[model samples]
Target: MIPELCDQRIRQFINGSDFVLAMNEDNHVFSWGDNHCGQCGRKATPFRVYLKPEVISDLNDKNITHICCGFKHSLALTTDGQVYGWGSYYEQYQNAEGSDTRVINSCENHYKSFFEELSDNPIGSGGFGTVFKVRHRFDEHIYAVKRIHKEDEIKNHMEVKNLVKVRSKYVVQYYNSWTEGIILYIQMELCEYNLQNILEVKLQVFGRQLGEAMDSVEYLISCEIFRQVLESVQYLHELNPQIIHRDLKPENILITLGKAMDCVEYLISCEIFRQILESVQYLHEMNPQIIHRDLKPENILIAENIRNGRFVKLCDFGLATVHDKRVHYRTTQKHTADVGDMRYIAPEVSQGGKYGHKCDIYSLALIGGNIFEIDLFNLELEDTNVYSELYQILNEPVYRLQTILISMFRTRLWHRRPECSEVLSEYNEWSIDRNILANDTRFDGILSILQSNDNHLFIELSAIGSGGFGTVFKVKHRFEEHIYAIKRVEIKDESEEYLQRFYNEVKNLIKVRSEYCVQYYNSWTEGNILYIHMELCEHNLQNILEVKQQVFDRKLGKAMDCVEYLISCEIFRQILESVQYLHEMNPQIIHRDLKPEN
Candidate 1:
């Protein structure tokens, strides 16, 4: 960090032909540019770049009036009629020179001494970012360096901040950042191929055969590339800051050159997509979360040099943010960035709404459309005897993608969009079991289930019943049809008595294995909500007693009083047997709360 200088305001800033100068609100002149000739008005380490802007407090006693910039020179005019000049004063060569800039003799840098001299290894340049190729002298390892220019520093601070923290096979590896004046040098792995290259080649080669001859082999490369893209995107979205590749296009993706060829590369692949879906799941399950505002075919990179040309790398973080998920939707809406790729941007984002990580799902949907060569925006909407341009343009991509992408998309709404993790487990051909759900060992008993770390799988329904210890609500797995009774106990500031009671119940449940007792499934905790999901019964003994009191009022109590007595006896006998089963265990257990409500 450049110490975050936003609190101060610049009165006026002017870059001299050789050096730069700016006055702040404090009437202070801050200088830090080409200081090759001591024109910066400050002493600095030889051959060292002034990474941070420095204040020139020497002119504090003088009321500065005018500033001038000349070729390789600078001048300052003060209100006292005093003039000063410093910079290249070589008048003879000024007209015959090929350049005004010159490098002075300097001592070697201890850090860079191990590396070879700088070569004009410029890779590419564009409005957003530029790449340069650099190699170590000893190891001869090549690295792709990003040159972040001055004006664009604000736009790239987040990128540099994020890239350095990421560690993943799918994401471009970040090495280190070297600061020099207003520019930043980001070192990273170099990959020559990107998904855009593959996509373009596919379109060019399979252009005519796309509609008619679409086969497994025809989509193998596309499928593999897509899978890897998902994995990288997932990895980024899962970071602590929950990175979002705000600008995801093929160009941002970097690749290696393995140059390996195999027939498996031409086969329809699930492994590639599997890695992506799982990675997304991990990110969605995080606390604050992430949302990649921009995603398109261009952001996906193909590394033909690595893993037989089967790897993918995700890049670009200019617009990404480590969002506070707890922030109000209105607050998020007000603070949202207006930058994104229009074609792949979620409609809600384009329409300006506060959204969560699911925005990436919408972008992913657009990517899916592109991969399938489907023009999502052209799809026909259901007609009510009329047509709306906005209606078709927005709904088309969503509707065409729902069948393929699996997660439900409320094209017009933000909250209604399906979660990123849910899609991986519930839909995609590369879908896997929800690892959280699969970890049965973690849910030992009712209390263990109630103390679950977080709740994402369950959708709490209406209150069904209550006991002395907790309230039971009927809840359903958000993606499944099965319903369960979730016993919720407020854990915040919970007394030891309640804790012991809950743990005792857990012990009893764990010790007593039976078909008669309610089955325990899972439990998790979030904030003050301590919850456990278990088998939901139609009625407890209390409900039975109340219904029987009315003499066959409810559906189940239609039996005669005598028959009901037998049923009651059977229920009591089963409860007693459950207690006996606990007593017989090596560590005897007891249901102290054996009342009708219990």
Candidate 2:
């Protein structure tokens, strides 16, 4: 009875026009439901109640391994890692004849012959269509072949054309495509796995629990991973043609294992972020804007592991679109089916309104929130229900944290959230502050001392110099027998900007430890005066120059040589390297007051 039922179901599947199936072990084809573009792969009958399974000639004898179906397109994979596709071809071509041998050709051919050779076989399938793994006949190298049903040939062609122009570490590379009978086949690089697989592994390792036993190190590593992913998305959104990976989900993201923890760390190092930013910036400057309508994890691919299992490559551009105001494609009237996944779709997208890169920002925040299991949109206010839960998890003051979280998850499209550039800046600031507080005990202790001292300590130092914002004095530490430079600043009591700048300067200088730049030893506030202690150098470059003009003596030349020698020293080399590092920073900051003296 079971065998009979199974056979009946198989027959029904084969006879149904809406159902389309491809078998790996045997190239068996089944169809049911809809068959608008002959998707059933069956010949049209004069009068029939249902369509019967028709064996595809091109796929016969091929050891099929996988099958993918787009809305109307179909793709098949073979054991030899070759991809074969069948579907509609909306692209038009012109056939012209040369009257004479010497006649010049005016019209160039835009289309290539279809299914002339089989290089790779299909391995995976997706919403837009199916993918195959093909091997080069001569070198036997493997590749991923993608076939879009003719129903989606135009959009697929545009995606392929756009992807070909942009070069990014997060994007998949497009190869070539052609038409065979009724199908269109596009071959591309064969990637390993998607991001979904990696997250699943992580979830399993953690016992499939959302927020259990997750440590600081794990969170830190995850934060770094999120940073890299955003950098890639930002790069795509910034492209000239401005390609957006509208569908960016974990399944589309790929990951590989590495040998050591540091390997992954190096893969997601600051240097890599710079590279990603530059690429995104280049994309943003393109002529036509590209918006990735779907920015979910499934659309991201993890091609390989960089640095021995430390970093991953992002892939999948099936739902990517160009955001061009001047060149608008009638998507509403034409292909009206829902475009994005339900989980990561932006609010604006869900409401059927137009969106730009900010939509990507919302999706990115969602991705971050999911990984951290922290809601970035709704702030945990004292009056809100989630406040107690948030307090328990963070174990710190929730007001400021709530403010930051609320600012991140604003609902209005334009006013709702900060730009990618801004988010990166905030992350950098927070990261630097955290590093300073964690690493510098003296500075941390100074904050405590300032809180207790109030108006106790008095400055008893000689004023040595003054600058635009503050004054520097050489003084003795009241309690310790140490001489230090105290920089005092006077600002309006209510000026948070001034206070922030002062603290930022201290933090920036302290975080920076290079021989070329003066280092921050300590900083404190007493009464109304803010004091910053820094390493004291004997002479400024301007003073040295003045001294040189006074006398060109042997001693002066030796002094200049000594200064030059110090600059040439390995320690000074490190200083120059540090300065270069600062210059290469994101947002490209410049030290405007780079003269010899502050």
Candidate 3:
């Protein structure tokens, strides 16, 4: 038994003039021995011998059912009734149809019979190849035909092979591929435009300005487009042999348009940063991680989806790299430095050091900053001075986003940076805090818990107040029927420092024993949220003052009534006494949240 065929379990063997073809139990084909005239389906010259069997990887998924060999030639038959032949039997394959064999030949005459070029001028041209508009003779449907000049005789080009392996709604669809003369032709789904065109149109509308930020509507559309792109990347990263789109720029991504909808509204706010991080998270989580070393805005494409409106298609995998499994962390070593655009490449990559999937996260942060028009100066600098310009122009939301971006741009301290999954989680919470998903149906399950349930002790009456820390709800005990206030604070950060602050607040509440102070009855933790039950007050200081103003209007202040003045003095005295009581504690507890609403 041949050692190479031992693992695969050889099912059948056929002999050529000086070579041998073996069919495995899995329907895979392997060839070896004399490879003269390419009978072995491998690159070889006359009399060249392959002592060990080499897999014909091109036909791995063909489900080859039978193999036949002729003098200096070979052929394989697949279960789907298709025939594939290579080597010296060129002329005989012309009449292969007569024998009921559908040959996957790509000769000049065969290509002309199947596809017809529509125009003399090429539709698009890039580093990979030149694209032309072509129509299938039988189906009469137009397709984008990419004609790549044969530079390498490696059977399959990287882009074509990657495209054939990927099947995603957000990726450009591959139809067919063939070789004609010295050119490789690939048929793909046609798109009207690319993301660059959209950006150009937006720039034109803004009078060719560069730094102008997109309005909320345009930003939302951009977010939707990026959401699909992230999903496509996630799909690639989840593949058995993970794929990385080494060249992730705008030009590679194509756009398709759909019918215009009337008065459409977006209920869920799209967090492009979060979506991007989620995609990268998948890549980093793989056993042998994949890294998209080249990631920029140019690689992102906008496409139309029938069910979801405008979406993004992530294209171009020419530079994607999978990690070497030999490494402990599955990181790639000796990667080509200065491979991607200077603006988006990570410091570790540009500096020619060992890097992992975190490099992609760095690129993602740069792209996120670009989408929001956040300027990142000297991104390689390990200081907040890189964000000095951002502080001057950005508002609160942008400020928070840039802070996250800065964490990703950790320069040489990349290990200290948060993982893509952590970044995504932070952004998810950010979206919720912004009330973007206030009406989102997905949150209905959590909101439903506010009603009387077996897990909860009280039934919520109403939302009394809400602030950055938590939301206070008026609730009645299910068994006791006593009204009380319950403050529910989501536990976003589980760090000891954050939890210590929360515990300290609870401690202070337990220690205080004053009639003026809100009495804390009990506290508990459930599902990443802290719940505190306290004595319910009829009105807060602000509510009482507002009601008093409405009752007297302008008359009370100007007329200076004695009864109203005395009531206001008593309220002020109580507030001062509460503050005094807290300060007089052994370890004085300062009420930081002392606003009127509190």
Strongest candidate by lDDT? 3
What TM-score do all the candidates reach, one by one?
0.26, 0.26, 0.34
Residue-wise C-alpha lDDT for candidate 1, range 1-598, written one tens digit per residue? 3353455587777786546777766455666666655556664334435435776645433345666666555556654344555556547434354223432212234225534433465676777567766666556666666777768656676676555456467777766554455666666777756656555556444333446653333354457668888888988777766876777888766556532211122112234443444545555666676555665567656566765434655556566555566574535334374557755566556546566676777777656544433333322334331211222332333333334453333254556666656555544332222332333353334335456543656777789887667888887876566888888887656788766766665655555557756887766566767677789885777876776756654465354567767877898898887667767767666555677866
lDDT of 1 at 468: 61
Clashing pairs in 3: 248-299, 249-298, 249-299, 249-300, 250-297, 250-298, 250-299, 251-298
Query: Which candidate gets the maximum TM-score versus the true structure?
Result: 3
Q: For candidate 3, what's the RMSD?
A: 27.6
- Alpha carbon lDDT of each predicted model: 0.57, 0.51, 0.68
Off-target runs (Cα >4 Å) in candidate 3 are: 1-28, 32-52, 57-73, 76-83, 86-106, 152-156, 203-216, 238-242, 256-598
**Candidate 2 accuracy as lDDT:** 0.51
What lDDT score goes with residue 295 in model 3?
74
Writing each residue's lDDT as its tens digit, candidate 3 over 29-81 gives 89888775677777655465454798887775455688999987788875434
Sort by TM-score, best first. Answer: 3, 1, 2
- Greater-lDDT candidate between 2 and 3: 3
